[model samples]
Target chain A: MHNSSRRGFMGKAFGAVAGVGAVGSLVAMKKTWDPLPSVKAAGFTTLDMSIYPEGKLITEKWRGKPIFILRKTKEMIDSQTESQATRDIVVAGIHYMIAIGLCTHLGCIPAYIPAEKEFHCACHGGQFDWSGQVTKTPPPRGLDIPPFKIEGNKMILGEVGPEFQAMKDSGVTL
Target chain B: MAHFTKATSVKDWLNQRLAVEKIEKVMASEYWIPKNINFLWAMGMILAITFALLLVSGIFLLMYYNPDVNLAFDSVNYTIMREVDFGWLWRHVHGVAASVVFLVIYIHMFTGIYYGSYKKGREMIWLSGMLLFVTFSAEAFSGYMLPWGQMSYWAGMVITNIFSLGGLHMDGLVEWIRGDYVPAQAFLTRFFMLHVFLLPLAIMGLIGLHFAALRIPHVNNQDGEEIDFDAEAKKYLDGDKAGSKVMRFANDFMSKDMMVVGIYLIFFFYLVFYNYGFAMDPVNFDPANGLKTPTHIYPEWYFLWSYEILRPFSINIGLMAFGFAQVIFMLLPWLDRSPNAVPASRRGKFKIWFWLLLVDMIVLTAMGKLPPQGIFSTIGLVAALGFIALWIALPFITMNEKKV
Candidate 1:
């Protein structure tokens, strides 16, 4: 009985050690799949807000997604509700609506219609108004506002700032 | 006239070491198949043939196909299709086989359900087959990415985005899965590796398991009659072959399987030559553009039923329904509470359930392809709910079934 019990304990102990080694190896393998440090370093993009002209929507690539920066003309700003005003980012006293260009419905890049001051996703007919709020069905929510910080006349994207955090906390952006 | 004297010395030499004769007898010659089975029983062999075609054609494509995001499109369209000799033919073969293989699998799957092949003794066969289906789906999704087309990029984007867990903000996990914030070079290479190497290995392993599972309980027959396989084989061996209800799996059953395979290949290659356009999406002709998405995006036809389930609801609810659709088929053996392993036609309520499920899936597939507009959206919602309702109703309806 003593010999059999000792053998059982040894077998279990060896099995446990082997299991730990296997788990450690799996963790190491999984770590290799994460975004590399260089990819993470290239995550942030800084753009001079003043360089973009008013009323014209320009698309720039940041972290491989289209970033839509529309310097809101007076007419565009006048069309928003009190709630919509809060979604706009003011940098150097300039009102601008910045959002990740992909449609909220299925991630298609929505085209900005300068005439109507609205974004239209041709893929599914999902429409977003000047403030990046959905003006059509199918898109469950508004165009997602990217994490950004305003400093002087420059906007840095992919960085969490107080303003972005406030919008997130208010459930305005995801 | 003795067997050993007639056999070649090389056969004897190898058989002495390997027990080749015993293995052949065990796996093939002495293995029994019911005589009541139909041409639908040939689907397993047809699926194996299709897989071999995919492997061969994929290897040819891989020789010229570049995995880089910058070069992959041109490498496929310009280099292979335009430059390599008969490359278009090989591509058409691969494309048609990939699409047609799913058709065969569905027929195989539905035939199993119709015959109650997943009854108590054959759960492993069904489970392993389901595993193969899931793996093939992954392989197809990964292979779809290799073309580096508009549909490829956007499909990758939409699918990876699902990992966010219906608004839980699991972007970290999604990004890790894509190897970047979006589908890029690393994403393409990793998916290529999975499509070519990892997934195929898993599929081959699962196929082995599926066949091995079939060996013990043997295949289910059409009438669901339980035959005495050993006694029938004994009858055949005793020169009472005309009285036996079972036949050898080797020369006898294999000859029938080959006849069905020959007819299937004619139909398959007909599509490869004349109707291959159905398999290669026109939207995918445009190179992958991260900045642009096609006007309409959808998965291949095989995945349409489940994809439709993911639409027409709130994000979280739709995802739940989609998850349910994906896993429900695998649980059919458990959900079906019927006592008899008989055909659906004889199973009373299950007969209606079977046909209704098939029609609902076809409706779902059609709705999935159309733009989710006013009427289409309503129909899609109804059909999606109906699918869930049918599966939910399965156990209650089946539990009271009278055994045949």
Candidate 2:
């Protein structure tokens, strides 16, 4: 009886180790050649937002995700939003309201700070101004907002492109 | 129908005849060989022929093979099973010959090591020989990766990671070795050219230098003694043997080396015909997929122990220890302090360590092949430290024994 049990235990142990080995092998083999997937409609759409004069920011989603657009008024544009919050969002000032939905701290989307012109990440007390710069610390960098181009009357926001340098030169930030 | 005319004049016949005679005379007079050559001296010629065979067969195999990650494994299979005529044979020869060449070199090097072949007069020959071995090793390794198989991919991954130890950021170095962020088509092409052209040329040049250096310092005969041709002949036999100018090539070393060369050729031909080249690792015929690690992953037989050594310890020091062991093995000549070159003279100390090192190497190689766990890994760890211990202890042992 003891011999049989021992044999059974040995068999099970071998099976378990072999199973792990097989899984590892499969995982290793799968990574050798990964063909790039085709682009999806999920990535094709762009966000749209309108900012107010105080470098007031608005957040909205274009491609099923939140975006920050900090529209700066002439006043805020001149001062470049001296508050650390606005200082973070002041990227040439094309889109003033920082609409980037991502939480600067842990990647959870932060709630808006309309009154003080800052983004307060609810998950953490991380703060960012109209410019999207992290005011309250802990977040590594400013929120990532999409690029915007003015299509006649509406500001059309989309993925950043090679023209981002010129956009920044023209007082725009993505 | 075209008609050909026969030779019309005696002058035409004489012109052809003397051309043949002149060719023979040049080969006969100065070029044939030294009369005192022996078996230990034959390795250079054998290595040359082995290298030539590898080069020729390697080039032929390359014609139908692809080195790209996507196509490398398949191309090798395609070449063997379908594409080129007798392509499989060529591939086999290339693969088998690679192992054989290393084996031959090991013996050749041991001959040097054991017989004090690298002592005062032939240090340059030894140096060139070492360089030749290094280049040959590199050539073989680069060629191994060209097949783009599962084993090749992982082998490259595990080997290159050794460079990344010691907080040494080799992101750039890794990229350079791979010829890209990943092993790809570019690496294969470069490796093919290196294996076929550059390395072979380097080998040839080193060989020429090796021979030139050897010629300058006349051949060392057996019994670990230099033959004082002038004094010995003068004392022994009315100076007759000494007076005879270095035996002419026609009746001397040429005849002997030719016989040896014939035997070598017979052996080479037998291997080529009977073995049909050599058995390739089946896994190599499958294309590299980074996601897949084969069940039994090891380097070519030459690098097995070191490969095994590097597997156990995840720590950086283990990797360094492994790499150091390999390079240090080649530095044994300088490492030992036995004073005398011959084994018998330094019998007590040298013989023991020589056997220890040999057994140590064998144990390490065996342990390297086992799954890197249990007794095998423990043995590998012990053997790695043992190499270091032997180097340190040999000197101490020699001193104590001398005092006794």
Q: lDDT scores for all predictions?
A: 0.91, 0.61
TM-score (C-alpha, index-matched) for candidate 2 = 0.60
**Mind giving the per-residue lDDT tens digits that candidate 1 earns over B308-333?**
88878766787789899989999999
- Where in model 2 is the C-alpha error above 4 Å? A1-174, B1-38, B229-251, B258-261, B264-270, B273-279, B343-346, B394-404
Clashing pairs in 1: none
Model 1's DockQ?
0.57
The parts of candidate 1 lying over 4 Å away from their true place are: A1-3, A113-127, A135-140, B1-8
TM-score of chain A of each: 0.88, 0.56
TM-scores, all candidates, are 0.95, 0.60
- Put down candidate 1 lDDT per residue, A29-145, tens digits, no spaces: 899898889999999999998888998888988999999888888976887698789788988988998999988765778887877878887655578888899988557789899
* Tens-digit lDDT track of model 2 for A1-174: 999999999999999999999999987755432321321233345333332444444555554345655566666666763443333333343535444465433234566656776666532245666666666644545665555554433555554544444545654333
Of candidate 1 chain B, the 10-residue stretch with the lowest lDDT total is B1-10
Compute the lDDT for candidate 2: 0.61
